[model samples]
Target: MDAAVAAIEESGPSGWSLRELARRAGVSHAAPAHHFGDKTGLLTALAAEGFGLLADALTAAGDGLLDLGVAYVRFAVRHRAYFEVMFRPELYRPDDPELTAARTRADELLGDAVRPLSPEPEAALAAWSIAHGFAGLWLSGALPPEVGTDPEAAARPVLGTLFPYDEDGRPAAEPPRER
Candidate 1:
């Protein structure tokens, strides 16, 4: 798994093979195939692992929506290899039971956090999109230098714009918008 993560980081999800992963892991060329069955199987496992890790991170962040958003970005940047493969459903089996359960867990965490903010279903989607979009921008180097190298710090204000909170984790009043 470590070798596979390294390969995904250095190349990309589709750029490496099971043979390459075996070679990097110092195992026989057929070892990865024997264990994971094929590249899709390996990626399915990776996607499941990524979602589980994400759920853990979000849970650690507590129930604060702002904190959850920051945690999402932090997980993506820290686990770039897993994050890359987890989102691209075309690369793996999205319907795999393990992957589905893991993904659903992460989604539920996010939805639970957003529920108090608005009763509307779109609120959860909007919150997820904001965090996911910001993470994608940070990973792609699309964010300006002024955003700084600290992902959590950078993410806080951006997420705050959508779901403002005070030091005590209570929702804060939105700032007045300019004409």
Candidate 2:
């Protein structure tokens, strides 16, 4: 897993090959195929692992949406390879059972996190969008330098723009309207 992560991070989704991965891992060329079946299977496994790790991180975020958003960005920055593959279904087999279960776990974590904010199903979607958007930007260094490169420190203020907290640190206004 670590070897795959390193290769993906260094070479991107399309840049790395299974044979190269085996070479990097100091294993036989057929080792990765034997373990994961093929490149797609390897990527699928990576995505599943990434989602599972994301779920764990988000679950560990014990605060409100801001905290969860921060965790999301942090996870993306921390697990660049997994985070990258998790969203690129074409890079892996979307119908894989383990992949589906892992993705579901991550989705359920976000859904549960947003449940208390609103009964509207869209709330979960909005929460995910904002967090993911910010995280992606942060990962790409698209965020301005003023926001700082630190994921957690930068996330509080930026995410707060979408879900501002009052002086008492409670969610401001009317539960943050999406439309």
Candidate 3:
């Protein structure tokens, strides 16, 4: 898996062949095919692994939505190959059972993070979109220097927009105090 990820990162969107992955893994040329069936099957497992890792990070962030968003961006930059493969469904088995389970695990975590505010699907989708979009932009180097290189630092203010604070920097849902 590590070798495949390295190959993907080094090869770009066209990705690497199973034989190449086998060679990198120091295995027989048919080893990857025997285990994964084909390139898409291997990519499906890769995508599942990526989503599972993302779920672990977000789960560790706990109930803090801001921290969760920050972790999302950080994970993207740290695991560029996995992130790239995970989103390109056409490159893998989009309906693979393991992939679906992994995606659901991540989705459940995101749902828990946003449940305190509202259980609306729109809220979850909006949060996912912003975090995903921000990470994608950062990975692509499309974000200007003003955004800075620190994923968490750059994402803080952007995520704060979706999860704002009051005068005291507390969530606005809290009761107001005297001036």
Candidate 4:
């Protein structure tokens, strides 16, 4: 898995093969195939693991939407390989039980975090879109240098813009709107 992650990071999700992973891991060329069945299986496993890890990180970030958004970005930047594969369902079996469960757990956690901020479902979707969009931009190196290299630090302010909170951790007042 380490070799696969490294290969995915260095190249991409489809750039490397099981044989290459085995070679990098110092195992027989057939080892990865024997363990994971095929590239899709391996990617499926990686996606499941990635979602599980993401769920853990978000849980640890507490129930705050801003903190959860930061955790999402942090997980993406740190686990680039997993993040790359997890969202691209074409690369893996999205209906796989393990993968579905993990993905569902992460989704539930995100929804729960956003619940207090707004009762509307759109709020959760918007928050997720903002975080995921920012993470994708950061990972693709499309974000400007002024954004800096610190994923957490950069993410906090941007996420705060969406779900602003006061010092006591309650949602802040919305700014006046133009007529």
Best by TM-score: 1
Where in model 4 is the C-alpha error above 4 Å?
168-170, 173-179
Expressed as tens digits, the lDDT of each residue in 61-115 for candidate 4 is: 8877878898899999999999999999999999999999999999999999888
Task: Look at candidate 3 and give me any clashing residue pairs.
Answer: none
Question: In terms of lDDT, which candidate is strongest?
Answer: 1
Model 2: per-residue Cα lDDT at residue 178: 62
For all candidates, the clash counts are 0, 0, 0, 0
lDDT of the structure predicted as candidate 3: 0.85
lDDT of 1 by residue, 23-97 (tens): 899999999999989999999999999999999999999988888999999999999999999999999999999
lDDT of 3 at 20: 84
For 1-179, candidate 3 gives per-residue lDDT tens digits of 88888987898746678888888889999999999998888889999999999999898876777778888998999999999999999989888899999999999898888777766787789889999999999988899999886888899799878866554434568422323
Please list the C-alpha lDDT of all candidates, in the order they appear: 0.91, 0.83, 0.85, 0.89
Q: Which lDDT value does model 3 have at 125? A: 90
User: Candidate 2 residues 79-135, lDDT tens each?
Assistant: 998988999999999998888998898888778767766777888888898889988
